[model samples]
Every structure is written in structure tokens, then in C-alpha cells.
Target: MAGIIGRNVNGNIAYLTALEPALPGFITNDHKFRANDGAYTEVIHTNAGLLGYVSDLGHVDFYPNGGTDMPGCDSAECDHARSYYYLGESLISGGFTGRRCATYVGAMTGNCVLWGNLNMGGLVPKTGSSGIFYLETNAAPPFSRG
Candidate 1:
């Protein structure tokens, strides 16, 4: 399955900085893995098991249309764009481990980088009779109007 998940960006700038191999088994299944432009956005996936979470390095930036060169907007007359960033982190317990990774970047004019942290937790793997079965959790935090 495919879908979009995350928060909406208003009028502000956002930036994300993450560490390498931040998480294990982290992957981007689609191009919408991160918010582009200066509008509310989120990461998208084609699989149904990969779970996702908010990262301490996650962030968003909003800029007036024609103000920034962000990827989410294209019209020169537009007035705003939203930016998003994701980081890799794990929240598994009981010997089971999971990690997260983020992708994407946007640079828009008149846009300032806003700093924020996102902490997400969920089941990235499934248990079966044979043992521990691992699947992409693609988990995301509950959607908000931020």
C-alpha cells in the first residue's frame, strides 16, 4: 500500500541533520519520503510493514512562494512552501531492535530553518511461531495539524 503521513508546515523554515547509518534496515520506498517545498508534508512508502518515527533531527521550514527554491512548490506566483526532514532512531525493547533513516532536502528563499524533535515508536517487526519475523514497520506518529 501507499500513503502520506506527518504534519503540516505553516510559515516557517525547517532543517534536518542526521548521522550516517543512523538506523539499520532503514529504506526509502518512494520519492515522498520527506516533505518538499514549503507546505505540510511527510514521508511515503510503497511497502506495508516498514515503520517510521519522528527523529530528533527532523524539522520543517516555511517560506513565501517565489521566496525559496524548495522542491514542494513550483509556481513562481505561489506564496509559501513547506519543508520536512527525517532522522534515524530506534525504540525497540526486549532484545528486539529497530532503527529509522530519513531523506530529502529543500532550500527556499525567504525561508528560515525551524528546529524541532520528533520521537516515534512502534512495531517494526512481527513475531511468528517460527521465531521473530522482521518486516518494515513504516510506522509514523499520529497525524497532527501542526
Candidate 2:
């Protein structure tokens, strides 16, 4: 394509010469010149204080590794396997709110908070039917043994 011709001196500026009429802009002897396209123009400078330009459309990648996988479960063994699972843990120090559920699943778990009420219809099964639901809380139920 097009090229640049110039001279360089220790304390003097460089200039470009013999440029075609199509090339627009001031041709300096101490700086490099380039033609700009429709999109963005890439500019690079050298240690000698010379600058260069290149037209770049952009770049695309087929695969991007941005931690797409779910967290907490380091391996298959850690996974509870049940489609709906909820696990929570909390520590009471000096009367703090304490930690809540660490992991949760299912539509309700994903949509509602752990302390929120669950409006299960009479038809809802308490035991296994399709998926098992597990809830781990800090406090035991009213009738639960210590």
C-alpha cells in the first residue's frame, strides 16, 4: 500500500516527502504519517518519538473464558444432585444478623429470600416426587429435638 519517507536527527524533527495528492494532512519530517479508513485508526509511537498509524476494523473471538460455570461446587461430588437444593449456614458472634443461606436452587430459591414465606399449595408434595428440596437453617423447628 502507501509508505512513509522521512529523516531523523538527535534534536531535530523529521519530515515526510514525495506524498501522492490523495494523501491529506501535513507531512512532518520527525513524525510518521498514515491514511485513515472509515473505522478507528491504530496509532503507535517508537522510542525515537516517531508515530505510526494503522486502520483497524476490530477483533472477534469465538471462545471467551469469563468464569461461565457456576461457583461453590468445585467438583461433581460437591453437587447435591437434586434439581432443587438449599444449604445455609450462620455464625452468631456479638448479636450480629449472622450469615444466611450459602447455596440455593429451584425457581422459588432463585426468586425469593431464605427468610421469605413459602406459599405451597395443598397439592404440593412434601417428599420426593420429581426433585428433592432441602433447607438448612441455624435454628431448629419448634418441635425439633436439640
Candidate 3:
């Protein structure tokens, strides 16, 4: 489920942007925001593997390397290999007076800021104020629809 998801001049796995949440010269994480109830979360990936989880509000917690058994997960006795992360709260802020993707900001501290009329990869807001969002292996169009 990892490595070489695409091919370009050579190979393309992930693309990191020079946004706030990312390190100076590296893209080391993947993110997804749930807007149904307004939640933003990300999975921390490292050279070793999935390091742990962090939220937009300012809560950080990591998992220790262990066997497949997770101790205080739930009644199902969760598996360490199969874990889930959640957002703590909404820390979205900026002078941006435009419609933001998902919850507006990157959802995590230092994360990038993507602004436009659409969320980019998911549902258009119920207010019908967003535009058609698409994600492909090509350069995005240079037009904005309201």
C-alpha cells in the first residue's frame, strides 16, 4: 500500500508543498479533513512507518512500537496495526475572507494553507458556494469558479 503510486519523468509518490505545517524542505505527512462535523486530522509518516497522529488545534500524541494489540482502545481491543486518529478542535484562523477547503486551514499547526472556492478533493459545501473540485495526475486548471 506504499511506494510508487505513480510514474512521471521517473517516479512520483508524494508531493509536499512549502506550507506552514510541513518541514522546511520535506513533505513528511498526509492529511484529510472531515467537515461533516468539522474535524481535521492527519497521519504522521516517517522513514520508519506511521509515526503517530496530530491535530489542528495543538494536540500531539504518538504510539509506541508494540505488538498488534492496543491496550486501552475499545471493547474490540484494537490492533496497533489498525489505528485511527481524530481532530481535537478547530484552530482555523486567518484574515482570509474567502471560502476555505474543508475546515479552512491545514487543520494542523504549521500545516499548509489551501484557499479557494472548493475543498479540492471532497464534497462541495452544502451552501452551494463551492465549485467543481477534482484531483488528477495532471496540472490543475487555472480558473476559479464560484
Candidate 4:
């Protein structure tokens, strides 16, 4: 585990280290770091000096005011099961362009807007299949409902 060795303000030797991924873009399961392995986990810093997660399907999930979990859900709930919002295949082709985003099943909440396509952890009635969902927050209004 190679890492950068440096000293803190107090002059004591300190180590600033993070694990490097074995492969490029092959990371999974960790939320505090960039999944790209070589890349440092990036964050969006607010004017108020708050650090927020960036929107990356493989990296991290962004919620309103930079929050990560949807409010009012239980740990056993399927919605909070994952850290990142599940981007359905071909659901968002061009990526989030407006202020608001939506999901088919998972539960999330944040400062931006959101649209729910189906109940969290529920099967999609039209397809009869279970789905995962997560969406980043934006400053625009929601584009769809349900």
C-alpha cells in the first residue's frame, strides 16, 4: 500500500494515503473515493465551503443540499440499499440536462428536484421487473411525474 508521506501542521510525520485500484474504471462498493482508481475522488465545493459528492454512476450519489439518503426510509428498505442511484439502461440517454431528475424505484432526496416513476423497491408494473434508482440533484424543475 504505497502512499504519500508528509508532515502535518504540528510537524509530526503523517501519511496521506488511499488505495489505488487494481484496474482502471473497475471499482465498486466504495463511496468515499473515486471509483476510477487512479483518479482522486472529486467533490463539488459550495460557496459556503461545504464539500459535496459529484454525480458519477460509478463514483457517488448526489442528493439535495448534498445529502445522500432519501428521508423516511428504513435500513431494511430496498431504496437505501445502494449508495449510487441506479441508472436504468437507456433511461437517461443524454444525462441530466435540467435541474430535476427522476428514478424508477429507489428512494433519494436532496436540495434539487426529483421525480418518482414507481414506488421504491417495488417492481415496475409495466415490465414486472425490479429496479434500482438514484439521481443527482440539479437546480431545474422536474421534467416528468411518475
Candidate 5:
């Protein structure tokens, strides 16, 4: 964390942020990260694929497919490329809504209930709130389910 910069970003930041793990080069669930000093974090993950859970960082975490192993994907490269796809679509359509989860387990298990919702990535930072979120997307394009 410190090597990337002169300080620990996982410690001090204030604003909305988003993360998507496209490759093993990005990170895996085994590594834990948290913005301990009032920074809101958002993690967009495709369940537990080759690029598994990134972290339960002290921010808004989104779990797609409930962290279940996704099927029809056989290449780590393709798995790595998907985050870009989602982000590209997200920027234009501005969909990909998520439901607040009661617990991290609830997000991982796709057991999110009828809590409030938030749009994942948007032109503006999703400020003033944070929580674990769950959303479903198509395995292919038109990925934003709103």
C-alpha cells in the first residue's frame, strides 16, 4: 500500500471511491484492505472467480452473483477483462444498481433483502452513505440491470 505512494491510502481518504478486480494482478480476497480513517470505499466484484473477493474494505462493497462461482467462463484473461466491460457500460448507461446487505456474508451469499439501494458507478460519487451491496448482471453484454 505504501509503495504505491508515500502513505497508506487504506488509512486516510475522504470521498467516494470504486474498485474492480480485473486480474490477479489487481488483488484477491485473501488480501484485506480497509480505509480506516473515514474514507468511503466501494468494491465491485464478480463473486469468486479467478479474481476473487478483493476485500471487505471499510467502504461500499458490491457482490455480483453472490460471490458464487460464475460459469461459462474458462479463461483467466476473459475474467480479467470483464471489469472493463462493466465499467464502460456503467459510464454511459449509468445503471448497475445494488441493494444494501445486512452483513458481508449476506452480500457474499446473495441474500440481500429489501433494504435501500444505490447506483454502483456514476458521474457523481455516491456520497453520504456506505454499505455492502448486491446486484446481478448478465453474463454477457447489456450488463447493466439498472
Candidate 6:
């Protein structure tokens, strides 16, 4: 089975790194990798919010509003906290959606002409998908325009 779940392993890097060679694919006897594995993503809070942690290899990386200074948030707290809000909203209401361009690099510049649409933070993962995504939300509750 897929083994040991770890997070923020900064302190244990050396130990973990040392064991990497000995372990077989990180010691997973039968680890199957998929695109939609648990909504893997890096959420970027526009404005006020810190750059925070980023996952370069996630199936989708959500950059809401495409800026650190989220449009509706009055303060940094609201902007940063919007990540949690977005997740909660996704569970109940229609989730936020992001539009990126053809390539990961092009998408970042806000040229969303391509069909790179992805829903951010969903109960079910978006399978067979991988790329950076961007979406805009309302300032208040029922944030999703969907």
C-alpha cells in the first residue's frame, strides 16, 4: 500500500533524503499515481495573502484572481482566509473555476483564450488533468459566479 503520509517535512529532510535511496519509490509497494489524486493543488492568495507553499507537480495550482491582492477582500486576513472559504464553498455550492491559456507559461499572463478551464477545490478530483489554473470570485458569500 501507499505508505507514510508526511507534511512540512523540512526538519526531517536529511533523514528522509537519506532513506530515499534505500526505499523503493519512497517505499510504496503499490503506489499508483493519477492526475486527479485528491485535488492536488497549490492555492495562491492574491494580494494580502502570502505566496505561501507551492506545488509545482500538483494536478492543478489555483491562483485565484491572479493576484495577491484579491479584488473584494478588504484586508490581508480576508484575502488569505479566502482559500479556506473557497474550499468550503466548493463542498456546498458550485466551486470556483479558473481559466488558463494553452501552456502553463502562457496561462500565467492571463491570456485565457484556450479551453484550459478547471474547477478549483472540489470534493472529487479532476482526473487526467494537470496545469496551473486561475479563477475570479465575488467579494462576499456565494463567491462563485456559477
- Each candidate: what lDDT? 0.22, 0.18, 0.21, 0.25, 0.60, 0.49
What TM-score do all the candidates reach, one by one? Answer: 0.17, 0.15, 0.19, 0.23, 0.70, 0.61
Best by TM-score: 5
Give the clashing pairs for model 5.
41-60, 47-67
Over 35-90, each residue of candidate 1 has an lDDT whose tens digit, in order, gives: 33222222221111212222211222111121132233344222111212212223
Better of 3 and 6 by TM-score: 6
Better of 4 and 5 by lDDT: 5
Task: Tell me the lDDT of candidate 1.
Answer: 0.22
Evaluate residue 23 in candidate 1 and report its C-alpha lDDT on the 0 to 100 scale.
20
TM-score of 2: 0.15
Model 4 Cα lDDT, one tens digit per residue, 54-128: 233212222322233323323323223222222221134322212333431122333334443222211121222
The sequence of per-residue lDDT tens digits that candidate 2 reaches over residues 10-107 is 21222111111111233333233332211111111100111111111111000001111113444323222111111111111111121112222232
Q: How far is 1's C-alpha from truth in model 6 (Å)?
A: 21
Query: lDDT per residue, candidate 5, 1-146, as tens digits?
Result: 32222124544555433344333554543334444433445566654545554445545777765644433446655554455566678788875888889886888777888569987775555656678888787877787777
> What TM-score should be assigned to candidate 1?
0.17
Judged by TM-score relative to the true structure, which candidate is superior, 2 or 5? Answer: 5
lDDT of 2: 0.18
Clashing pairs in 4: 64-110, 64-111, 65-111, 85-134, 86-134, 99-140
Among the numbered candidates, top lDDT falls to 5
Per-residue CA lDDT of model 3 for 82-138, tens digit only, reads: 222111111122111222224312321213234553222122212323221121111
Give the clash count for each candidate.
34, 5, 4, 6, 2, 7
Instruction: Give the Å shift of residue 136 in candidate 1.
Output: 19
